[model samples]
Target: MDNEEVKLLLVKYITGEATVQELEQVKQWISAHPENEQYFAQLYETWHNMLYLQPAVVNKDNAFNKLSADIEPKQPSRYARLITWGKAAAAIALLTAVTATLYTRYSKNVESVRQIAANPGAIKKIVLSDGTQVWLNAGSKLNYTADFGKTTRTVYLEGEAFFDIAPGKKTVPFIVNTKNYTIRDIGTKFNLKAYATDPFFETTVVKGEVSVEGNIDNNVHEMSRIYVKPRQVLRIYYHPKKESYSYTAPDTKNLNEIQVSEIDSAKLDRYDGWKENLLVFDGTTLSDIAKVLERRYNVTINMTDAELSSIRYSGSFKNIPSIEKVLAIIKANTAINYSVSGNTVNITRNNNND
Candidate 1:
């Protein structure tokens, strides 16, 4: 079936209104591809969260119409309209929640806010209301409010994204907020990587420049702002216990450090190649590389030996080669052997550590 039909069936299935045939169709579609299953899981999580939300005074007809217009301009099917309001109330609420979360009028005058997510092994490209283009990497999320370009243009990010920001009228200043730092654009193109699970946060500028400021004790450290030029990379090594780096914290002096380095054209390509479906590893340890492989291929990789996991290798794979091929390449370069069972790959050290 077409995408719209599948989506409608998924909604029906979530609301307990799908017929047996429709249910089987959804199962078949989900089983057909790994991405489908991931989509369903995300959808189900949103629906589940809506259950705990207090019911707001939402105009049902207006909400439904807005949802339909946003999702698809075409008319919804009769079956979609016939769904019992009692059964579809949660779904409708979910749609409303996803579209915008209402805030008090005094708070930034924000009318609506939205979030976009890219599941593991998927990359998504989106254009903001302000005309800025963003490419979200696998397992990343971006959040912005309705009044995006009115007074200030800012986006909250988790994970990685490549941004080509559109210059605003009167120079409103585009800003990206992460867990540890805030990057202010100087009318530039840049890449930001700040995954929560990662020990380091990095930003690489491709064109123009950006100012990187650390967030300290929930405040922006204006004094710590660092201007980064094109071809320069700013990397911050931080620990979870101390979320941010402080200029005065002696205890964290060793735990947190900032480094700015100049990179060659080849290194710049390696940083931005994920947007082109390229996986590049430059002297990355096997353990760390496995994390990237897992997100890119949606598989579990287990290294049986600690020393094997610490082995560092560098290589590049374009167009997303299969997990087996990637592992084979690694095997050829290192003294390692691996076996795949279903979606899991187990790695063990060879007889010699050469």
Candidate 2:
């Protein structure tokens, strides 16, 4: 058979509309060449991402025209024609899903905002409309508009996420918005932790460069903007006023703090290891480690003794099923004791000060 026939068969295969004979033929073709299998994989991912496009944007004619331009010469060999038909069918199916769903669920008046959240007990990996890949840590949320990657690419983030962005687009630069700061990427890979409850926000650059911009509330201009390179971390602290004194006393709320420092390659990798369900710590305080454990295990950790909270810990855990194992490791290394009550774990110093 010619290329046109093969392309048609491939399209039918993707849409699950192919007959058993056609399916066998396509499978044989795929198995014949390694590059053929890779091509099919790439097309599959493209089709998957295309499904998320806004309804208003996708039209049959527009999609067909675009596909035609890419695979030129209207009249080609049967084999080539078949490939084109399969590709076009895949694109049409993706566009159809968006348009059909939009008519029923989404309004055309407002741009749809897509939110991908990792619940307290789960971690999620998502591919944004712009093809940027994100691995969200537990209790983290990532939101972006459906019209993303059109004129501008922007995403709002709460909690922690590791982003591997596509190459720089002059018109649509990738921007990650947190509560306190905005990270603008110039084709970079970075891990960001920006939980609202946390005292500080952290951004660790793994590759390329990212410019971070900070602004005051409702301000038209940015307060500060700084660029971060690979193997470096930028932390911004939020300090709220704790005391209210006499009328004569002035309010003394510490301004947000920003700190940038170089991190070792080994340590930087550990920082990004949360996506792999690995927890690695180096000299991390028990207080801070407790927060990490709480998020990972979806449990409450209470430190009964203040001294025990300050104890430094260093360890690595790989998909350990039980929290008791983690506490046992800590207890073995330090003078700390822990008790589990229901879903809560209480830690105290072994000296019986609490």
Candidate 3:
């Protein structure tokens, strides 16, 4: 209640003589205010250090003299307890110093870094501690701090992932960090792709809103941030020359660009089907298709023919048959011949049929 009452409670607590009611009251007092917690922690540390001190080193009369002179009546009310402890106040100071050293060493052992990696050809589903659902695509990885969803919710991404972020405490926003940019969610559902080898980073929003921010000059002034609505797609193309640009298109080639465009909500599966173990290609080029198949099936598709690589194909297949079967279906759709030997498949234009 008051400073003297709190000091007596602290003494009882340190000596393990506190009743249940007194313990709960102290806990409530400490939690009610940040400064209260800090004050109690300092006294707690000092009391803890006194436990380990040798009896011979304790000079009760000298400690009493020092404490009497050190504490002034006009100081903070909490410090008045030092005079009340009398000779014990000197031991508390010594113990407080020892506690600081121990606390520093203990803090070093606390690791907050955490990571989850998805294997190639298999999707991994994860639910964060905050009830956020994530479908990590094949050959992808996600890392976050252990303190995630506490003060803030942030995760680093490599490759692709579909996030269905739950509405968390409104004070703390959820963020997905990529190599080039960051996507901040406001109770949203979105698909993010940032494969290391791919020249572009992409985000497709299914519902709600998300902000994508990019840094071109690596400074606050040069950063670009944009918001995407539902049924819209944002693509950020990275240039080797470090040039910055933006456009609005359904698709883009290798260039220095950031594009955002509207897409049909019915066609959302075309972008998010991989999370359901289905592969969909909508007029996707053979070269790009090859990379997708390689990541999805964990196989090598070699197509050295320049003409064959440029062919566009559109198809959707569920996870019923093998990748070889999928390739066979593609080969039948196009006039392409494939020779498979073990894990490698070589594709060439069907010259004989043509």
* Per-model TM-score versus the true fold: 0.63, 0.63, 0.63
Task: Give the alpha-carbon lDDT of every model.
Answer: 0.67, 0.67, 0.68
Clashes of 2: 12
Span of 10 residues, lowest total lDDT, candidate 2: 244-253
Residue 285 lDDT, candidate 3, scale 0-100: 93
How would you encode candidate 3's per-residue C-alpha lDDT over 1-354 as one tens digit per residue?
644566566555543456678877767776765444544554443333222222224544444343333222234544434433333454345334433433342222123446787888889999999999999999998877666766557677878999999998654678776655668875789999988777678899999999875443323323245778999998777554334222212122234676778998778888899999888888999988888888888878888788998899999989844677888899888888887787788989988767
User: What ordering of candidates by lDDT runs from best to worst?
Assistant: 3, 1, 2
How much does candidate 2 score in TM-score? 0.63
Question: What does candidate 2 score in Cα RMSD to the true structure?
Answer: 17.4
Q: Per-residue alpha-carbon lDDT of model 1 for 1-354, expressed as tens digits?
A: 644465577766644456667778878876765434543544443332232111223344454444334333133332233223322343344334433432111122222446788998889999988889999998888877665676457677878999998887534578887755678874679999977667777899999899875432213333446788999998877654556533222222243667789999778867888888988889989988887888777788888798977889999998856889988998999899999998898999998756
Better model by lDDT: candidate 2 vs candidate 3: 3
Q: How many residue pairs collide in each prediction? A: 0, 12, 0
TM-score for candidate 1, residues paired by index: 0.63
User: Which stretches of model 1 miss by more than 4 angstroms?
Assistant: 1-111, 216-222, 240-255
